[model samples]
Target: MKDFPSCFGESGVQVADFSSSTSRTAQNLVSCVYQCRLRGRSRLITVSWSKNLMGQGFSVGIDDNTNQCLCKVDIKPWLFSKKKGSKSLEADSSKIDIIWDLSSAKFGSGPEPLEGFYLGIVFERRMILLLGDMRKEAFKKTSATPVPSDPIFIAKREHIFGKKIFSTKVQFCDNGQLHDLVIECDTSAVSDPCLMIRVDSQTVMQVKRLRWKFRGNNTILVDGLAVEVFWDVHNWLFGTSLGNAVFMFKTNPSAEKLWVSQPLSDPHMLPWSWSQRFQDSQSQCLGFSLILYAWKNE
Candidate 1:
């Protein structure tokens, strides 16, 4: 399969581009992309949360509708003396600001904070993207007018470390049921290595002779919604050490449309039918994409 661009690139999977020396799988990070509007113009904001030996930190990047980056700001962990502050920038003669407070934030195993934190992106004194539970605190701290932009959660990319079985919790829908996801693959057997995916302790998808079918897509029903699952495990089956596999779960209308659009000649180059979904998600939308970079822990 033709290797697609690293989905986790925006999520801090590879820090080299971010001018960091950390290895790909060394740091725990999560990248979430949101579709928001500012001054009647739609834009995409990428919020990345990272945690390493130094502690937790985050970065905010704003991109236009055409995917052109308007501005990017990195808040280093050491620079968080107040742990809550605002950074203002000029974008197209307009003021773009990023405000955050993580001093009293509570976190779980992941880099993202669970509570007592607020990260707000304000444009022209209007809050475009707001995260965390402290909405009132975020508005009060930033002095941003309460304009409801209603940012849509479009995509999420995360790195998961494991050996044979990788597990994580994800919610397919907003405020929906959170399901347990388990991916088990024993690649020790070069001849016959089976791959299985379980959701909520139930097998949702399985591939028996995974060697030949290392890269493909499947459709599984979750919460009465069809989820298109795309997997690329070519590195796991054949590659040097430190190789990682990529999996994407997207909620779409019809799985047949996703499969039929692909050319049958080359199955490896799985043309992800995301152009339409991406457009829909930005416009009249409520689509969620979860991308996991599974790293084998040796």
Candidate 2:
């Protein structure tokens, strides 16, 4: 009997051990999750959206040397299903009558090549999203941009309903220059609903109205400005909004304080009339953290 780490959090489940008999080399592990423990012990649960593989399911394993507990189970086989034609076939059905396609074809290829898994671990009041595989080196090179260690705050806006982020914008004063950074999520959308930004340890001027246009037709407009820079940001908020939200913070360099403004507004001029139908609002501030997830282009 192995002494496993005590499970924490409201989930009431602890992950004891996980492993796959299939070679981890040829196949890329897409995602893994530890579901509610079985019989009060951690049960390994995993999801692999791979096309090439078979016997795709969760597996459980224990470390023999450590006397740790382990379990393995196959959820579903990765076998393709074929549909028979309408013709009434005799006892000997031709194999050609059935179509052979990857089991994942039903869902369609999501991104491409099915890259390795990216794990976001939040432990002991800290958050870190680890990017795995060959892409790790590339991420390091691109993220080398000098980001402030003690940043006043960080915001990560993800599209809850949509396929991906419509746009990402960052506003901050760097070396006396007020800079605005924007990136389009998908060019075809022409506008984005979600927006996020972070400010370093510097106070911002407070005003009634602030506006800016980024890559997409998306525009941000904000009212009211307040500032406070402490506490992890994640615990303070929740919900799915496609607009800007104001976060207040005080700068270490200035006693007067400043506002870190994010304008969340509708993209009125977007080609799709449905775009106007989308609502823009802000959720409560959950908390704050400096760590965020970034992907490397292949």
Total colliding residue pairs, candidate 1:
1
Local accuracy of candidate 1 as per-residue lDDT tens digits, 1-298? 1222222235422342211224544468787887777777777788888877677788887766555567777876556567888899777679998888888999888888989999998888788888999999988877888666477777777778787999888888766798999999988745789999999999999998888888788889999988888887877888745677878898855433443334322222445543344445444554787878787877
TM-score of each: 0.83, 0.21
lDDT for 124 (candidate 1) = 83
State residue 212's C-alpha deviation in candidate 1, in Å: 1.8
Whose TM-score is greatest here? 1
Screening candidate 1 with a backbone cut-off below 3 angstroms (N, C-alpha, C), the clashing residue pairs are 1-268
Model 1 worst lDDT window (10 residues):
12-21
TM-score of 1: 0.83
